[model samples]
Target: MNTNTIEREIAIEAPVERVWSLITQAEHLGTWFGDAGANIDLRPGGALEVRWDGHTLIGTVDAVEPTSRFTFRWHQLDTPAGADLTEQNSTLVEFTLTSEGDTTHVRLVESGFGSLALPAEQQVAMHADHSGGWPVELGHLKDHAAVVAA
Candidate 1:
């Protein structure tokens, strides 16, 4: 019913400070996020590129709040680089981290699928693709954090 968004929450067995660095730092993000790699500016209005299966998804950072939150807007699957990102062509991704004693509670939400100007089939497919992928990626983050904490 909520094809417009995908949400995943994960608990990383690490402090908020460490998890914040893992998420915001480009080197860590590249390994856990995309196969080819990623380059993130990590500031508001900065550029973001995460390569997945040979496709480089372009995005712009919208917010950064140290260990608390990070947000961005990125174009969908098959979108070409250098293409302008309009509201109908991109989705907003928000990462919210809540400190829980020595652990970090991470909640990720990606929305805007219903507004995409893509064909109905493509929209549904992309929504489905991300629906399945976010949990796995969050799992990766959790595992990676565990390693780093170890």
Candidate 2:
């Protein structure tokens, strides 16, 4: 596993289409990703904003292949609201879904930490924080998917 990237996978007891809808739709994103809310355009190069605890993280869609892949880039460090989020200041997040029988495998990858223009310590801390966060977030997603499937 690359130190600059965080990767995680979860097997959800749901169909590919159901898992895709939970991951891509703005309303469903709020439950598993951002508790406050989310607003997404749902297309390549579309805008995505996830709100949590009064802060909104802005992102840009990179890919949207239904039930297969979804990718985006978002700022990894704290920046002023409305700041332009470019690759230089952001990290790439990718989600790939695969269907296995009755279950859907969801894989998440977040990379580009080494390129951020931040102190080395802060970069390490940020990486560690996200490393610990993905599993918890994926757990929430898995739980939600199970509930919805029930």
Candidate 3:
């Protein structure tokens, strides 16, 4: 496939700490990320679970650098419930925050699609789905951040 990683960035008109809370905390994350709800243990190696639509996605926290960087690894494709999520079946999702005066610049990258243990066409389709999803997701995040800041 021609794609393996999806990177998107947005400048939120909010302080770094405010942006960080929205991204790392479970409550705010559900509003912008999972629609249904989220339960994230915000620390390195902690468990991250997000429920969207009718499915629950499980992930492991890869890094949490408070107000700066947060990352996790999770299966990007639909697998049967109870499927073991490991590096062999998952992609890494990273969120980075940088302060620009009063605004926070948020960058998100989801990579490792080429390593998934799935059919080639399925891998390509998964990558394309996320590529289209990030802009809409980030736009929601930006709007949510604005409302929270107001």
**Top model number, TM-score:** 2
Cα deviation at 98, candidate 1, in Å, is: 0.1
Using all chains and alpha carbons, the TM-scores for the candidates as numbered come to 0.92, 0.92, 0.91
| Candidate 1 lDDT tens digits, 49-101 | 88778777689999999999999999875556577777788999999999989
Poorest 10 consecutive residues by lDDT, candidate 2? 79-88
TM-score, prediction 1: 0.92
lDDT of 2 by residue, 1-150 (tens): 466889899999899999999999998888788899899999988999988878777898899999999999997767887787775689999999999988999999999888899887787888899999899889988988888753
Better of 1 and 3 by lDDT: 3
TM-score leaderboard ranking:
2, 1, 3
Task: Put down candidate 3 lDDT per residue, 17-63, tens digits, no spaces.
Answer: 99999998898888888889899998888889988889777888899
Which 10 consecutive positions of candidate 1 have the poorest summed lDDT?
76-85
How far in Å is the alpha carbon of 139 misplaced in model 1?
A: 0.8
lDDT of 2: 0.88
Question: lDDT score, residue 104, model 2?
Answer: 94
Pairs of colliding residues, candidate 3:
none
